[model samples]
Target: MTDTTTTAPAHGVTISEAAADKVHRLLVQEGRDDLRLRVAVQPGGCSGLIYQLYFDERVLDGDAVVEFPAADGATVEVVVDRMSVPYLDDSKIDFEDSIEKQGFTIDNPNAQGSCACGDSFS
Candidate 1:
């Protein structure tokens, strides 16, 4: 961990645990190794920018990787950068398994508003 980077506590964010577990399970099912869940912000959502999450294998310099214990007792890591921290820091990621919806949703405290389509954020 870097000076400015820290991991979330076990009783911290709610969504993070589920997201980490889902990511871990996905990697395992896909037969992947050494992959990290990369979350970032890029311009072009309904708002000014949208959240981006994906499995990444490459680790860049200055990247902040947050490690959390999964439900299965494995450590899951999410890598972000200095720039994307403010938008994603302290944010919770959860999986929606309802019949009407099934995907990862972000609960970001920094987000002011999101687009109608749910692709962009203010």
Candidate 2:
């Protein structure tokens, strides 16, 4: 289920509390509040498209910005470029910290098929 808190943005994408917490910790570690989590789709993965997730300080034109509340009461901003909106609309981002897996994961409903590595989508 998607986050329905007041901090949730009008943007279609939703970031789980766990993911927001992780992002918050990362930002604190870098001592930079200017960074925003940027999610973009780039070409050239095995399935023809790949996900690029990183912290960006720049806000380009036509970027969709969303603010999610972190565990510490601070807000974590998630940015998605206009071009990637269609590909990531309604997508949910989550963080898993388990023995089997440990990292951020994207549950994109728009993805018709993803590569075996889960790094690309068509």
Least well predicted 10-residue stretch by lDDT in candidate 1: 3-12
Residue ranges of candidate 2 with Cα displaced over 4 Å: 1-8
The candidate scoring highest on TM-score is 2
Q: Point to the candidate with the largest lDDT.
A: 2
Question: Model 1, which residues run further than 4 Å from truth?
Answer: 1-15
TM-score of each: 0.84, 0.92
Query: What tens digits encode model 2's per-residue C-alpha lDDT throughout 1-122?
Result: 22324454545789999999999999999999999999999997889999999999988878878788898689898988889989898999999999999999999999999999998999
- Screening candidate 1 with a backbone cut-off below 3 angstroms (N, C-alpha, C), the clashing residue pairs are 15-93, 45-120, 46-120
